[model samples]
Target: MPRSLRARKLENAVGLAVIVALAIASVLPLIHILYMVIVRGVEAIARIGLYRFLTEPPHPFDPQNPGGIGPALVGSLELSGLAIAVATLIALPASVLIAEFRGSRISRGTLLLALTLVEFPTILVGLTVYAVLVDHVVGGYNMLAGAVALTLVILPYMAVQASEALRGVPEGVREAAYSLGATRLKTVYALIAPAARRGILVGILIGLARAAGETAPLLFTVGGAYEGYHLCLYKVGGAVPLMIYQFIQMPYKPAQDLAWGAALVLMTIIVGVMLLARLLVKEVKIL
Candidate 1:
């Protein structure tokens, strides 16, 4: 081979080797963590009874006394669901508007502002929301406050992802729709939105996953409670992350084990969401 071609081949080999090594290094920790979580968590789940653990309050799982995490799971689902809904309601339209009107000064400013929001820390977002909604207005920590805080934390990221997805819609498609005499809104809704639906769905799924795993924002806004799982929105609810955090500091072995199980459950949930998102995207592409 010519000298230049030989040098190029060597460089490509080196790059491939580095990429493979880095991929393995990046995945090792996740693999180990998942392995440990599955082992320990499965043991706990089996001992406690998966149905019971999913439908009852956390209690000692000894022969004398058995308890489950039903309430915590319910609360987690409720809070996370609410947060995801609110965030998507705000972010999706904003993203579409921004993407469709990139040249407008207002849209440009709004995009910049959303970008800034993405960099804000979860703790600060929690504190700000708590102060505005809970302390100043509502006068107490509640589900609404927690949801608002989480929405703020997830919205900017979702918006940015959505904007990118919307922008990715082919210009040719838009022009064709316009040539067909479709209004801007109609074209966006009928063509661009459907074409980029997979990306938008993936972004929303990611946002949901982020909201589900958040703890710092929930700390101030959702304040944990051990009892009263069936309370109203104003009532405090215990979450798995907060529960794990609280339990990890205790002197009890059972609490420690429960914390590990909770961690495993949370990871399982986020991973499941991600897998579903991937499957959805794949299916959309296939169709």
Candidate 2:
């Protein structure tokens, strides 16, 4: 082989090695964190009984007086659910409009506004929600306020992603739909939306995952309480991330163990959503 060709081959091999090394370095921290959580959490889960641990409130892990995390789980679900619902309602239509009219001044303005919103610090959003809802409106910290704040934080990201997904639908398909005498609205709703359904779903799932793990925004809005399960949207409730934060501050080993378990569960949920989104995208491509 020519010396130049051999040199190029050597360079390619070195580049490949560097890429592999970087990838490993990036992944190792995540793996280490997961391992630590699992190892620590498993003992707590086993001792408390999985069902009891998941269903009860935070209590000192005593065989006689074991308390589970059932209430926190429910509260997390409700808060996250409310946030996701609000974000979806706000994002879907906005995304559709932006995607369909990308070149218009309105679309341009909306895009810029969304970018601005997304870039705003989460603490700022939390403080704003606290001031407006807790001080000005509702008079105290509540789940509704927290949900609203989370929705605001997540909405811009979801909308921007949804718009990008809708734009990914081929122009040819849109033109053909128009040629078939479909109204512009009909073309968008029936044709473009269905075509990009996977992408939209992925965007929503990603938004949900992001919203679920947010701690700073929830801190000011949803004042963390250790009370047992309550469904009142006006009542403050504990969330996994908040609980983890609270637990880590305690000097007790049990609280720390429980924190690890909650962290693991949260991580699992986010990863599950991501995997489902990836599967949906893959399935859509296959079809």
| Top of the candidates by lDDT | 2
Q: Candidate 1 at 281: error in angstroms?
A: 3.3
Alpha-carbon RMSD, each predicted model? 4.0, 3.5
Per-residue lDDT of 172-256 in model 1, one digit per residue for the tens? 9999999999999999989998898888888888888888888899888877775557446776777778777877787776666
Q: Alpha carbon lDDT of residue 83, candidate 1? A: 81
Error of 1 at 60 (Å): 6.1
- Model 1 off-target regions past 4 Å? 1-23, 60-66, 282-287
Report the Cα lDDT for residue 179, model 1.
Answer: 98
Note the Cα lDDT for every prediction shown.
Answer: 0.81, 0.83
Which portions of model 2 show Cα errors greater than 4 Å? 1-16, 61-66, 282-287
Q: Tens-digit lDDT track for model 2 on 1-287? A: 45798899999999999999999999999899889888877777787788888888877445455466777788788888999898999899999888888899999999888878877888889999999988888887888888888899889988887888899899999899989999998999898988988888887888888788888888888788866776777877778888889888887777777787788788889889988988887642211
